[model samples]
Target: MTKNNAKAYWKENLRYLFILLSIWFIVSFGAGILLKDTLNHISIGGFKLGFWFAQQGAIYVFVILIFVYVRLMNKLDKKYGFDN
Candidate 1:
Protein backbone atom coordinates (compact mmCIF):
# COMPACT_ATOMS: atom_id res chain seq x y z
CA MET A 1 0.00 0.00 0.00
CA THR A 2 1.02 3.61 -0.50
CA LYS A 3 2.25 5.57 2.52
CA ASN A 4 -0.95 7.62 2.73
CA ASN A 5 -3.12 4.51 2.56
CA ALA A 6 -1.07 2.74 5.21
CA LYS A 7 -1.39 5.75 7.52
CA ALA A 8 -5.14 5.82 6.98
CA TYR A 9 -5.43 2.14 7.78
CA TRP A 10 -3.55 2.54 11.03
CA LYS A 11 -5.72 5.52 11.92
CA GLU A 12 -8.88 3.56 11.36
CA ASN A 13 -7.61 0.64 13.39
CA LEU A 14 -6.67 2.91 16.27
CA ARG A 15 -10.07 4.56 16.15
CA TYR A 16 -11.85 1.23 16.40
CA LEU A 17 -9.61 0.12 19.24
CA PHE A 18 -10.30 3.28 21.20
CA ILE A 19 -14.05 3.01 20.69
CA LEU A 20 -14.22 -0.66 21.66
CA LEU A 21 -12.09 -0.11 24.74
CA SER A 22 -14.24 2.82 25.79
CA ILE A 23 -17.37 0.70 25.64
CA TRP A 24 -15.67 -2.08 27.53
CA PHE A 25 -14.66 0.30 30.29
CA ILE A 26 -18.13 1.78 30.45
CA VAL A 27 -19.77 -1.62 30.81
CA SER A 28 -17.19 -3.07 33.19
CA PHE A 29 -16.28 -0.14 35.40
CA GLY A 30 -18.71 2.69 34.78
CA ALA A 31 -21.96 0.75 34.89
CA GLY A 32 -20.62 -1.79 37.35
CA ILE A 33 -19.26 0.72 39.86
CA LEU A 34 -19.79 4.39 39.16
CA LEU A 35 -23.42 4.04 38.14
CA LYS A 36 -24.41 0.99 40.08
CA ASP A 37 -27.03 2.59 42.32
CA THR A 38 -28.64 4.47 39.48
CA LEU A 39 -28.83 1.31 37.42
CA ASN A 40 -30.17 -0.64 40.31
CA HIS A 41 -33.48 1.14 39.87
CA ILE A 42 -34.08 -1.05 36.84
CA SER A 43 -34.08 -4.84 36.86
CA ILE A 44 -33.94 -7.61 34.30
CA GLY A 45 -35.06 -11.14 35.04
CA GLY A 46 -34.91 -10.34 38.75
CA PHE A 47 -31.36 -9.08 38.53
CA LYS A 48 -30.34 -5.46 38.69
CA LEU A 49 -28.36 -4.27 35.69
CA GLY A 50 -25.53 -2.94 37.74
CA PHE A 51 -25.31 -6.01 39.90
CA TRP A 52 -25.49 -8.26 36.90
CA PHE A 53 -22.77 -6.28 35.17
CA ALA A 54 -20.47 -6.48 38.13
CA GLN A 55 -21.14 -10.14 38.73
CA GLN A 56 -21.35 -11.64 35.25
CA GLY A 57 -22.30 -9.26 32.49
CA ALA A 58 -18.88 -7.66 32.20
CA ILE A 59 -17.17 -10.99 31.61
CA TYR A 60 -19.72 -11.89 28.96
CA VAL A 61 -19.31 -8.51 27.33
CA PHE A 62 -15.54 -8.90 27.34
CA VAL A 63 -15.83 -12.24 25.57
CA ILE A 64 -18.19 -10.85 22.98
CA LEU A 65 -15.96 -7.83 22.51
CA ILE A 66 -12.97 -10.06 21.82
CA PHE A 67 -14.90 -11.86 19.09
CA VAL A 68 -16.17 -8.60 17.70
CA TYR A 69 -12.66 -7.16 17.59
CA VAL A 70 -11.36 -10.26 15.88
CA ARG A 71 -14.10 -10.16 13.25
CA LEU A 72 -13.71 -6.44 12.67
CA MET A 73 -9.94 -6.64 12.45
CA ASN A 74 -10.17 -9.50 9.96
CA LYS A 75 -12.52 -7.48 7.79
CA LEU A 76 -10.31 -4.43 8.11
CA ASP A 77 -7.23 -6.42 7.18
CA LYS A 78 -8.94 -7.79 4.10
CA LYS A 79 -10.20 -4.39 3.07
CA TYR A 80 -6.75 -2.89 3.42
CA GLY A 81 -5.14 -5.79 1.57
CA PHE A 82 -3.17 -6.77 4.60
CA ASP A 83 -4.58 -10.24 5.03
CA ASN A 84 -2.65 -13.30 3.93
Candidate 2:
Protein backbone atom coordinates (compact mmCIF):
# COMPACT_ATOMS: atom_id res chain seq x y z
CA MET A 1 0.00 0.00 0.00
CA THR A 2 1.03 3.59 -0.60
CA LYS A 3 2.17 5.83 2.27
CA ASN A 4 -1.09 7.76 2.29
CA ASN A 5 -3.14 4.54 2.30
CA ALA A 6 -1.06 3.17 5.12
CA LYS A 7 -1.51 6.33 7.18
CA ALA A 8 -5.26 6.36 6.58
CA TYR A 9 -5.57 2.70 7.48
CA TRP A 10 -3.63 3.17 10.68
CA LYS A 11 -5.70 6.21 11.55
CA GLU A 12 -8.93 4.30 11.08
CA ASN A 13 -7.61 1.38 13.11
CA LEU A 14 -6.74 3.73 15.95
CA ARG A 15 -10.17 5.29 15.80
CA TYR A 16 -11.78 1.86 16.02
CA LEU A 17 -9.57 0.94 18.94
CA PHE A 18 -10.42 4.12 20.80
CA ILE A 19 -14.14 3.71 20.33
CA LEU A 20 -14.21 0.04 21.29
CA LEU A 21 -12.00 0.53 24.33
CA SER A 22 -14.14 3.42 25.47
CA ILE A 23 -17.21 1.19 25.32
CA TRP A 24 -15.53 -1.50 27.38
CA PHE A 25 -14.40 1.03 29.93
CA ILE A 26 -17.88 2.44 30.24
CA VAL A 27 -19.40 -0.96 30.77
CA SER A 28 -16.76 -2.26 33.14
CA PHE A 29 -16.01 0.89 35.12
CA GLY A 30 -18.98 3.14 34.62
CA ALA A 31 -21.79 0.67 35.07
CA GLY A 32 -19.86 -1.66 37.33
CA ILE A 33 -18.51 0.95 39.71
CA LEU A 34 -19.64 4.52 39.27
CA LEU A 35 -23.29 3.66 38.83
CA LYS A 36 -23.35 0.49 40.84
CA ASP A 37 -25.92 1.62 43.37
CA THR A 38 -28.43 2.70 40.74
CA LEU A 39 -27.83 -0.42 38.72
CA ASN A 40 -28.10 -2.62 41.78
CA HIS A 41 -31.76 -1.69 42.01
CA ILE A 42 -32.30 -3.66 38.84
CA SER A 43 -31.89 -7.40 38.67
CA ILE A 44 -31.10 -9.88 35.95
CA GLY A 45 -31.81 -13.57 36.56
CA GLY A 46 -31.99 -12.75 40.28
CA PHE A 47 -28.55 -11.14 40.32
CA LYS A 48 -28.06 -7.44 40.91
CA LEU A 49 -27.31 -5.73 37.63
CA GLY A 50 -24.28 -3.89 38.97
CA PHE A 51 -22.84 -6.99 40.57
CA TRP A 52 -23.47 -8.94 37.41
CA PHE A 53 -21.70 -6.35 35.32
CA ALA A 54 -18.78 -6.22 37.70
CA GLN A 55 -18.49 -9.98 37.63
CA GLN A 56 -19.83 -11.27 34.32
CA GLY A 57 -21.43 -8.61 32.14
CA ALA A 58 -18.20 -6.75 31.58
CA ILE A 59 -16.48 -9.97 30.55
CA TYR A 60 -19.27 -10.84 28.16
CA VAL A 61 -19.18 -7.37 26.66
CA PHE A 62 -15.44 -7.58 26.20
CA VAL A 63 -15.79 -10.87 24.35
CA ILE A 64 -18.53 -9.48 22.15
CA LEU A 65 -16.42 -6.44 21.41
CA ILE A 66 -13.62 -8.72 20.28
CA PHE A 67 -15.85 -10.22 17.61
CA VAL A 68 -17.13 -6.79 16.70
CA TYR A 69 -13.60 -5.50 16.29
CA VAL A 70 -12.68 -8.46 14.10
CA ARG A 71 -15.68 -7.92 11.83
CA LEU A 72 -14.94 -4.22 11.65
CA MET A 73 -11.30 -4.83 10.79
CA ASN A 74 -12.29 -7.27 8.06
CA LYS A 75 -14.50 -4.67 6.45
CA LEU A 76 -11.84 -2.05 6.89
CA ASP A 77 -9.25 -4.31 5.26
CA LYS A 78 -11.55 -4.87 2.29
CA LYS A 79 -12.19 -1.17 1.98
CA TYR A 80 -8.45 -0.52 1.75
CA GLY A 81 -7.81 -3.41 -0.64
CA PHE A 82 -5.76 -5.14 2.04
CA ASP A 83 -8.03 -8.13 2.52
CA ASN A 84 -5.47 -10.67 1.33
Candidate 3:
Protein backbone atom coordinates (compact mmCIF):
# COMPACT_ATOMS: atom_id res chain seq x y z
CA MET A 1 0.00 0.00 0.00
CA THR A 2 1.03 3.58 -0.49
CA LYS A 3 2.11 5.68 2.46
CA ASN A 4 -1.17 7.58 2.52
CA ASN A 5 -3.20 4.40 2.50
CA ALA A 6 -1.06 2.92 5.22
CA LYS A 7 -1.45 6.00 7.35
CA ALA A 8 -5.21 5.96 6.90
CA TYR A 9 -5.33 2.28 7.82
CA TRP A 10 -3.37 2.92 10.98
CA LYS A 11 -5.61 5.83 11.95
CA GLU A 12 -8.72 3.75 11.52
CA ASN A 13 -7.20 0.86 13.42
CA LEU A 14 -6.31 3.16 16.29
CA ARG A 15 -9.89 4.40 16.48
CA TYR A 16 -11.23 0.89 16.70
CA LEU A 17 -8.59 -0.06 19.22
CA PHE A 18 -9.54 2.83 21.49
CA ILE A 19 -13.24 2.03 21.28
CA LEU A 20 -12.73 -1.65 22.03
CA LEU A 21 -10.36 -0.95 24.90
CA SER A 22 -12.74 1.58 26.39
CA ILE A 23 -15.57 -0.90 26.36
CA TRP A 24 -13.35 -3.54 27.93
CA PHE A 25 -12.46 -1.16 30.68
CA ILE A 26 -16.04 -0.04 31.26
CA VAL A 27 -17.41 -3.55 31.55
CA SER A 28 -14.57 -4.89 33.65
CA PHE A 29 -13.88 -1.97 35.93
CA GLY A 30 -16.72 0.50 35.59
CA ALA A 31 -19.62 -1.87 35.95
CA GLY A 32 -17.76 -4.16 38.28
CA ILE A 33 -16.50 -1.47 40.59
CA LEU A 34 -17.79 2.03 40.07
CA LEU A 35 -21.40 1.09 39.46
CA LYS A 36 -21.65 -2.08 41.49
CA ASP A 37 -24.02 -0.72 44.08
CA THR A 38 -26.27 1.01 41.61
CA LEU A 39 -26.63 -2.21 39.66
CA ASN A 40 -27.50 -4.31 42.67
CA HIS A 41 -31.16 -3.38 42.46
CA ILE A 42 -31.43 -5.37 39.26
CA SER A 43 -31.25 -9.13 39.50
CA ILE A 44 -31.00 -12.11 37.23
CA GLY A 45 -31.63 -15.67 38.40
CA GLY A 46 -31.86 -14.60 42.02
CA PHE A 47 -28.42 -13.03 41.97
CA LYS A 48 -27.94 -9.30 42.28
CA LEU A 49 -26.69 -7.83 39.05
CA GLY A 50 -23.92 -5.76 40.56
CA PHE A 51 -22.58 -8.52 42.72
CA TRP A 52 -22.87 -10.98 39.91
CA PHE A 53 -21.03 -8.67 37.57
CA ALA A 54 -18.32 -8.06 40.11
CA GLN A 55 -17.86 -11.70 40.96
CA GLN A 56 -18.52 -13.51 37.68
CA GLY A 57 -20.24 -11.55 34.94
CA ALA A 58 -17.29 -9.28 34.28
CA ILE A 59 -14.96 -12.23 33.85
CA TYR A 60 -17.36 -13.84 31.42
CA VAL A 61 -17.73 -10.60 29.52
CA PHE A 62 -13.97 -10.16 29.41
CA VAL A 63 -13.57 -13.62 27.94
CA ILE A 64 -16.25 -13.03 25.35
CA LEU A 65 -14.80 -9.65 24.50
CA ILE A 66 -11.42 -11.23 23.89
CA PHE A 67 -12.90 -13.59 21.35
CA VAL A 68 -14.94 -10.82 19.80
CA TYR A 69 -11.87 -8.61 19.52
CA VAL A 70 -9.93 -11.43 17.91
CA ARG A 71 -12.69 -11.99 15.37
CA LEU A 72 -12.95 -8.30 14.64
CA MET A 73 -9.20 -7.95 14.24
CA ASN A 74 -9.16 -10.90 11.86
CA LYS A 75 -11.85 -9.32 9.75
CA LEU A 76 -10.13 -5.97 9.80
CA ASP A 77 -6.84 -7.55 8.81
CA LYS A 78 -8.48 -9.30 5.89
CA LYS A 79 -10.29 -6.19 4.76
CA TYR A 80 -7.10 -4.13 4.88
CA GLY A 81 -5.01 -6.84 3.18
CA PHE A 82 -2.89 -7.17 6.29
CA ASP A 83 -3.60 -10.78 7.01
CA ASN A 84 -0.94 -13.43 6.63
Candidate 4:
Protein backbone atom coordinates (compact mmCIF):
# COMPACT_ATOMS: atom_id res chain seq x y z
CA MET A 1 0.00 0.00 0.00
CA THR A 2 0.99 3.58 -0.54
CA LYS A 3 2.12 5.62 2.48
CA ASN A 4 -1.11 7.60 2.74
CA ASN A 5 -3.24 4.50 2.30
CA ALA A 6 -1.24 2.62 4.92
CA LYS A 7 -1.67 5.47 7.36
CA ALA A 8 -5.40 5.62 6.74
CA TYR A 9 -5.73 1.90 7.11
CA TRP A 10 -3.92 1.88 10.42
CA LYS A 11 -5.88 4.83 11.71
CA GLU A 12 -9.20 3.19 10.99
CA ASN A 13 -7.99 -0.12 12.39
CA LEU A 14 -6.92 1.51 15.64
CA ARG A 15 -10.19 3.37 15.93
CA TYR A 16 -12.19 0.18 15.59
CA LEU A 17 -9.89 -1.62 18.02
CA PHE A 18 -10.18 1.10 20.63
CA ILE A 19 -13.96 1.25 20.40
CA LEU A 20 -14.40 -2.54 20.69
CA LEU A 21 -11.93 -2.77 23.56
CA SER A 22 -13.67 0.03 25.41
CA ILE A 23 -16.98 -1.79 25.15
CA TRP A 24 -15.41 -5.04 26.36
CA PHE A 25 -13.78 -3.30 29.32
CA ILE A 26 -16.96 -1.55 30.33
CA VAL A 27 -19.03 -4.73 30.13
CA SER A 28 -16.50 -6.81 32.03
CA PHE A 29 -15.34 -4.29 34.61
CA GLY A 30 -18.07 -1.68 34.90
CA ALA A 31 -21.13 -3.89 34.65
CA GLY A 32 -19.56 -6.75 36.53
CA ILE A 33 -18.18 -4.71 39.46
CA LEU A 34 -18.39 -0.95 39.45
CA LEU A 35 -22.02 -0.89 38.47
CA LYS A 36 -22.96 -4.35 39.69
CA ASP A 37 -25.43 -3.27 42.32
CA THR A 38 -27.18 -0.98 39.89
CA LEU A 39 -27.37 -3.65 37.23
CA ASN A 40 -28.42 -6.28 39.71
CA HIS A 41 -31.75 -4.51 39.97
CA ILE A 42 -32.46 -5.86 36.51
CA SER A 43 -32.87 -9.57 35.81
CA ILE A 44 -32.39 -11.87 32.84
CA GLY A 45 -33.89 -15.36 32.84
CA GLY A 46 -34.05 -15.20 36.64
CA PHE A 47 -30.38 -14.35 36.93
CA LYS A 48 -29.15 -10.97 38.12
CA LEU A 49 -27.77 -8.86 35.31
CA GLY A 50 -24.57 -8.11 37.14
CA PHE A 51 -23.94 -11.71 38.04
CA TRP A 52 -24.63 -12.81 34.49
CA PHE A 53 -22.14 -10.35 33.13
CA ALA A 54 -19.53 -11.40 35.64
CA GLN A 55 -19.88 -15.05 34.72
CA GLN A 56 -21.22 -15.35 31.17
CA GLY A 57 -22.50 -12.14 29.66
CA ALA A 58 -19.07 -10.63 29.24
CA ILE A 59 -17.77 -13.70 27.46
CA TYR A 60 -20.73 -13.66 25.07
CA VAL A 61 -20.20 -9.97 24.35
CA PHE A 62 -16.49 -10.51 23.80
CA VAL A 63 -17.16 -13.23 21.25
CA ILE A 64 -19.66 -11.02 19.49
CA LEU A 65 -17.13 -8.22 19.46
CA ILE A 66 -14.56 -10.47 17.84
CA PHE A 67 -16.97 -11.24 15.02
CA VAL A 68 -17.82 -7.57 14.72
CA TYR A 69 -14.16 -6.64 14.53
CA VAL A 70 -13.47 -9.23 11.88
CA ARG A 71 -16.43 -8.11 9.76
CA LEU A 72 -15.51 -4.45 10.09
CA MET A 73 -11.86 -5.02 9.35
CA ASN A 74 -12.77 -7.00 6.27
CA LYS A 75 -14.76 -4.09 4.94
CA LEU A 76 -12.00 -1.71 5.87
CA ASP A 77 -9.43 -3.89 4.17
CA LYS A 78 -11.49 -3.91 1.00
CA LYS A 79 -11.98 -0.16 1.16
CA TYR A 80 -8.25 0.42 1.50
CA GLY A 81 -7.36 -2.04 -1.27
CA PHE A 82 -5.64 -4.33 1.21
CA ASP A 83 -7.88 -7.34 0.70
CA ASN A 84 -6.89 -10.28 -1.42
Candidate 5:
Protein backbone atom coordinates (compact mmCIF):
# COMPACT_ATOMS: atom_id res chain seq x y z
CA MET A 1 0.00 0.00 0.00
CA THR A 2 3.00 2.28 0.25
CA LYS A 3 3.76 4.54 -2.73
CA ASN A 4 6.90 2.59 -3.58
CA ASN A 5 5.06 -0.70 -3.51
CA ALA A 6 2.29 0.73 -5.65
CA LYS A 7 4.79 2.00 -8.18
CA ALA A 8 6.60 -1.31 -8.27
CA TYR A 9 3.35 -3.19 -8.72
CA TRP A 10 2.26 -0.98 -11.57
CA LYS A 11 5.67 -1.27 -13.20
CA GLU A 12 5.50 -5.01 -13.07
CA ASN A 13 1.99 -4.97 -14.46
CA LEU A 14 3.05 -2.81 -17.36
CA ARG A 15 6.00 -5.06 -18.07
CA TYR A 16 3.72 -8.06 -18.29
CA LEU A 17 1.33 -6.15 -20.50
CA PHE A 18 4.14 -5.19 -22.82
CA ILE A 19 5.49 -8.69 -23.07
CA LEU A 20 2.08 -10.18 -23.82
CA LEU A 21 1.27 -7.55 -26.42
CA SER A 22 4.60 -8.03 -28.10
CA ILE A 23 3.90 -11.72 -28.48
CA TRP A 24 0.53 -10.92 -30.01
CA PHE A 25 1.96 -8.41 -32.44
CA ILE A 26 4.69 -10.77 -33.53
CA VAL A 27 2.27 -13.62 -34.12
CA SER A 28 -0.32 -11.49 -35.89
CA PHE A 29 1.95 -9.30 -37.93
CA GLY A 30 5.09 -11.32 -38.39
CA ALA A 31 3.53 -14.64 -39.27
CA GLY A 32 0.67 -13.06 -41.17
CA ILE A 33 2.70 -10.64 -43.24
CA LEU A 34 6.42 -10.15 -42.81
CA LEU A 35 7.23 -13.84 -42.75
CA LYS A 36 4.39 -14.94 -44.96
CA ASP A 37 6.55 -16.18 -47.76
CA THR A 38 8.81 -18.19 -45.56
CA LEU A 39 5.89 -19.72 -43.73
CA ASN A 40 4.04 -20.40 -46.93
CA HIS A 41 6.43 -23.25 -47.57
CA ILE A 42 4.74 -25.04 -44.70
CA SER A 43 1.11 -26.11 -44.57
CA ILE A 44 -1.36 -27.10 -41.91
CA GLY A 45 -4.58 -28.95 -42.76
CA GLY A 46 -3.89 -28.15 -46.39
CA PHE A 47 -3.80 -24.45 -45.68
CA LYS A 48 -0.65 -22.43 -45.95
CA LEU A 49 0.76 -21.57 -42.56
CA GLY A 50 0.98 -17.91 -43.43
CA PHE A 51 -2.56 -17.79 -44.71
CA TRP A 52 -3.82 -19.56 -41.64
CA PHE A 53 -2.05 -17.06 -39.44
CA ALA A 54 -3.57 -14.18 -41.34
CA GLN A 55 -7.07 -15.54 -40.97
CA GLN A 56 -7.13 -17.70 -37.85
CA GLY A 57 -3.77 -18.24 -36.19
CA ALA A 58 -3.62 -14.71 -34.94
CA ILE A 59 -7.00 -15.05 -33.31
CA TYR A 60 -6.05 -18.31 -31.62
CA VAL A 61 -2.84 -16.76 -30.39
CA PHE A 62 -4.73 -13.76 -29.10
CA VAL A 63 -7.12 -15.91 -27.09
CA ILE A 64 -4.29 -17.95 -25.67
CA LEU A 65 -2.47 -14.78 -24.75
CA ILE A 66 -5.50 -13.55 -22.86
CA PHE A 67 -5.55 -16.65 -20.70
CA VAL A 68 -1.81 -16.39 -20.17
CA TYR A 69 -2.15 -12.78 -19.16
CA VAL A 70 -4.84 -13.59 -16.65
CA ARG A 71 -2.78 -16.38 -15.12
CA LEU A 72 0.32 -14.19 -14.95
CA MET A 73 -1.56 -11.28 -13.42
CA ASN A 74 -3.03 -13.57 -10.80
CA LYS A 75 0.48 -14.69 -9.87
CA LEU A 76 1.63 -11.11 -9.82
CA ASP A 77 -1.22 -10.12 -7.58
CA LYS A 78 -0.33 -12.88 -5.18
CA LYS A 79 3.32 -11.89 -5.26
CA TYR A 80 2.43 -8.32 -4.32
CA GLY A 81 0.08 -9.46 -1.55
CA PHE A 82 -2.86 -7.97 -3.38
CA ASP A 83 -4.77 -11.14 -4.04
CA ASN A 84 -7.98 -11.80 -2.18
Candidate 6:
Protein backbone atom coordinates (compact mmCIF):
# COMPACT_ATOMS: atom_id res chain seq x y z
CA MET A 1 0.00 0.00 0.00
CA THR A 2 1.08 3.54 -0.57
CA LYS A 3 2.17 5.59 2.48
CA ASN A 4 -1.07 7.55 2.50
CA ASN A 5 -3.17 4.41 2.28
CA ALA A 6 -1.19 2.79 5.09
CA LYS A 7 -1.65 5.85 7.28
CA ALA A 8 -5.38 5.91 6.67
CA TYR A 9 -5.65 2.20 7.39
CA TRP A 10 -3.93 2.58 10.73
CA LYS A 11 -6.04 5.61 11.59
CA GLU A 12 -9.23 3.72 11.00
CA ASN A 13 -7.92 0.70 12.90
CA LEU A 14 -7.09 2.87 15.90
CA ARG A 15 -10.52 4.45 15.81
CA TYR A 16 -12.17 1.04 15.92
CA LEU A 17 -9.96 -0.04 18.78
CA PHE A 18 -10.78 3.10 20.73
CA ILE A 19 -14.53 2.69 20.30
CA LEU A 20 -14.53 -0.99 21.20
CA LEU A 21 -12.34 -0.48 24.25
CA SER A 22 -14.58 2.34 25.43
CA ILE A 23 -17.60 0.09 25.29
CA TRP A 24 -15.83 -2.59 27.27
CA PHE A 25 -14.79 -0.09 29.86
CA ILE A 26 -18.31 1.23 30.27
CA VAL A 27 -19.80 -2.25 30.59
CA SER A 28 -17.13 -3.52 32.94
CA PHE A 29 -16.38 -0.51 35.10
CA GLY A 30 -19.42 1.69 34.75
CA ALA A 31 -22.09 -0.95 35.08
CA GLY A 32 -20.13 -3.20 37.36
CA ILE A 33 -18.78 -0.68 39.83
CA LEU A 34 -19.82 2.88 39.31
CA LEU A 35 -23.50 2.16 38.84
CA LYS A 36 -23.69 -0.92 40.96
CA ASP A 37 -26.36 0.30 43.33
CA THR A 38 -28.74 1.38 40.59
CA LEU A 39 -28.16 -1.81 38.65
CA ASN A 40 -28.54 -3.96 41.73
CA HIS A 41 -32.22 -3.06 41.84
CA ILE A 42 -32.62 -5.21 38.75
CA SER A 43 -32.10 -8.94 38.54
CA ILE A 44 -31.16 -11.44 35.90
CA GLY A 45 -31.70 -15.16 36.47
CA GLY A 46 -32.17 -14.31 40.17
CA PHE A 47 -28.80 -12.63 40.43
CA LYS A 48 -28.43 -8.92 41.02
CA LEU A 49 -27.52 -7.22 37.78
CA GLY A 50 -24.61 -5.33 39.24
CA PHE A 51 -23.20 -8.40 40.90
CA TRP A 52 -23.68 -10.33 37.71
CA PHE A 53 -21.88 -7.70 35.75
CA ALA A 54 -19.03 -7.69 38.21
CA GLN A 55 -18.75 -11.46 38.06
CA GLN A 56 -20.05 -12.76 34.73
CA GLY A 57 -21.66 -10.09 32.64
CA ALA A 58 -18.45 -8.25 31.97
CA ILE A 59 -16.78 -11.45 30.83
CA TYR A 60 -19.61 -12.22 28.45
CA VAL A 61 -19.48 -8.71 27.03
CA PHE A 62 -15.72 -8.91 26.57
CA VAL A 63 -16.03 -12.16 24.65
CA ILE A 64 -18.77 -10.75 22.48
CA LEU A 65 -16.63 -7.70 21.83
CA ILE A 66 -13.82 -9.96 20.73
CA PHE A 67 -16.00 -11.46 18.03
CA VAL A 68 -17.20 -7.99 17.08
CA TYR A 69 -13.64 -6.77 16.79
CA VAL A 70 -12.67 -9.72 14.62
CA ARG A 71 -15.56 -9.09 12.26
CA LEU A 72 -14.80 -5.40 12.15
CA MET A 73 -11.13 -6.00 11.48
CA ASN A 74 -11.95 -8.39 8.68
CA LYS A 75 -14.06 -5.75 7.01
CA LEU A 76 -11.40 -3.16 7.59
CA ASP A 77 -8.75 -5.38 6.11
CA LYS A 78 -10.83 -5.91 3.01
CA LYS A 79 -11.49 -2.21 2.72
CA TYR A 80 -7.77 -1.46 2.82
CA GLY A 81 -6.87 -4.32 0.48
CA PHE A 82 -4.99 -6.02 3.31
CA ASP A 83 -7.08 -9.18 3.38
CA ASN A 84 -4.55 -11.12 1.32
Go through the candidates in order and give the C-alpha RMSD of each one to the true structure: 1.1, 1.2, 1.4, 1.0, 1.3, 1.0
lDDT of 2 by residue, 1-84 (tens): 899998999999999999999999999999999999999999988899999999989999999999999999999999999999
Q: Which sections of candidate 6 miss by over 4 Å?
A: none
Give stretches of model 2 more than 4 Å off: none
Task: Please state the error at residue 63 of candidate 5 in Å.
Answer: 0.4
Model 3 lDDT, full chain set? 0.84
List runs of model 1 lying over 4 Å from the truth: none
Tell me each candidate's TM-score. Answer: 0.91, 0.90, 0.85, 0.93, 0.89, 0.92
lDDT of each: 0.93, 0.96, 0.84, 0.95, 0.93, 0.95
Model 2, position 75: C-alpha lDDT score: 99
| Cα-lDDT of candidate 6 | 0.95
| TM-score of predicted structure 3 | 0.85
Per-residue lDDT of model 1, residues 1-84, tens digit only:
799878989999999999999989999889999999999999999999899999998999999999999999999999989998
TM-score, candidate 5, is: 0.89
* Model 4 segments more than 4 A misplaced: none
lDDT of 4 by residue, 1-84 (tens): 789999999999999999999999999999998999999999988999999999998999999999999999999999999999
Who is ahead in TM-score, 2 or 3?
2
Across residues 36-65, which tens digit of lDDT does each residue of candidate 3 receive?
899988989989988898889888888987
Residue 55 miss distance in model 5 (angstroms): 1.1
Worst 10 residues of 1 by lDDT: 1-10
Ranking by TM-score: 4, 6, 1, 2, 5, 3
Clashing residue pairs found in predicted model 4: none
Q: Note the clash tally of each candidate.
A: 0, 0, 0, 0, 0, 0
Ranking by lDDT: 2, 6, 4, 1, 5, 3
